[model samples]
Target chain A: MNIIMSKTITYLQRVEFGDCDPAGIVWFPNFFRWIDAASRHFFIECGVPPWHETEKTTGVIGTPLVDTHARFVKTASYGDVLHVRVHVAEWRDKSFVQRYRIERVNPDKTGDEMTLIMECEEVRIFAARREDGAGIRALPIPAEIRALCS
Target chain B: MNIIMSKTITYLQRVEFGDCDPAGIVWFPNFFRWIDAASRHFFIECGVPPWHETEKTTGVIGTPLVDTHARFVKTASYGDVLHVRVHVAEWRDKSFVQRYRIERVNPDKTGDEMTLIMECEEVRIFAARREDGAGIRALPIPAEIRALCS
Candidate 1:
């Protein structure tokens, strides 16, 4: 069997004061925010059209997260430059797993050392608008979309 | 063995337009944000002092999440009033499990029907400032705090 590996994408951002809590460290929820953004960026970088366009033509509105697990490794603070490495780990019939590794550059360390801030794995589905127009339902993985991402 | 259940606290909030994405549904990370707020509200309702006070008195800074698992059940949109019910599920020596059930009232349905939007279970620890003040370290579960919550 020929196995194709999903492409990896790196998203970069600087931690801001508003992103930190009273403890002077980055608030945990902000990590989820960045991770979500990274997930979207990965798809966009892989040549997938925006969800709005897909919703019109392919009935695919967006990838909605169904399950997630996360682990926090180290603390980060304002002014820190962070990077989120994102990739699709697996593609199932109607769902896929996305993984993220968040890291921060260590200024005091030599030779480009980085500290791991957090890691997360999320299961998401290609969602289509429901007939009642109130919610969404999962759709089977589209071959074209999968080809573009892989 | 006698098992004592922790008291539950409900936090209510209104969804704002900014909390949503272009798809017009509530962004998933906003759920994590609300859950974090509900966790703190649970401690407040249980008579625990704010983290700053605890830091000075007991050296306990705040409860920081180490791990989490979440399942999104339904979609929500702006202007919806959401209720997050939170409680401690288990207490360990250095960490504890906090659970949240997020729901919304459905006016279109009769008899005060509510819709479950998501559920989450988080493992957190009461953290103390490290000696060098650069990061945090887990602390043993405080008896007084546990008693108040239970």
Candidate 2:
């Protein structure tokens, strides 16, 4: 797999205080949430509008993480400006693979320069429903949207 | 799999308001974290101090979740007294599986009368390590300790 550098995509988010764990570093689990949120945003940026805008949509639903792999390279703390770059590496029959590279953008000494915090890949199954409870299942990527991901 | 109605393992935790998303239910992702913490406690109750007390001895350093299968049986609200129940169902050379059920206990519905809210099962792999990260591999269940899990 060719490593795509940060220059390819434009998804960025500032780490919020809530993202940190008792240890002060961003909890390992929250990274998945941040990247997932950004991936939702990246697609919306690609014209899907399905991520953070989820609650507002009239009948829109969400995609749930089916499989996720992350390797924590560095620690991320509260107040860190995380420059997250995302890309769709593979499009499957009813699911797709989203890759994420999270970096701490603020400069410091050991903490200064942009340090690679984590490299992760997550597979999410999409769903569409509006009700009290729902399950995420694989569905065909609409022709209009599949083209954008391609 | 035979269903087991087990005792509720109460782990007191402060609600991190960030656990909720815009819709207000504890964001689905955080439920997995709570499951993790409770699962660790269950192991400790079985006489396995994750990483074997971290400093005294070393066998497996960490037992992180490798795969998770969860059903959002119900929605859980934020700041609720989450009554979590855990059961060890299967064990393997490198990993073990446990089922978790979480519920919102009501004052009126005390003891076995609490309503069931959510259930999740997470599969975790064990490791042995230290603060600086040092451990070999998952050791076999020590005979003395294995007795408690029964």
Q: Which candidate should be chosen as best, given DockQ against the real structure?
A: 1
- Tens digits of per-residue lDDT, candidate 2, A15-132, equal 7788764334465567667776777777677767654454355333566555565565566677778888888787787777778888888556665577787887767656544354
How does model 1 fare in lDDT?
A: 0.92
Off by over 4 Å in 2: A1-28, A50-150, B1-16, B47-54, B58-60, B104-118, B130-136
Q: After superposition, how far is residue B81 of candidate 2 from its true place, in Å?
A: 3.6
TM-score of 1: 0.94
TM-score of chain A of each: 0.94, 0.76
lDDT of each: 0.92, 0.63
Candidate 1: C-alpha RMSD to true structure equals 1.8
> Which candidate has the highest TM-score of all?
1
lDDT of candidate 1 at residue B68, scale 0 to 100: 94
DockQ of all candidate complexes: 0.81, 0.14
Query: Residue-wise lDDT of candidate 1 within A1-150, one digit each (tens)?
Result: 987767999999799999998878888989988998999899999999988899899999889899999998889999999999999999999999999999998878677689899999999999998898877899999989898888
The Cα error of candidate 1 at residue B47, in Å, is 0.7
lDDT of residue B100 for candidate 1: 96
Alpha-carbon RMSD to native, per candidate:
1.8, 7.3
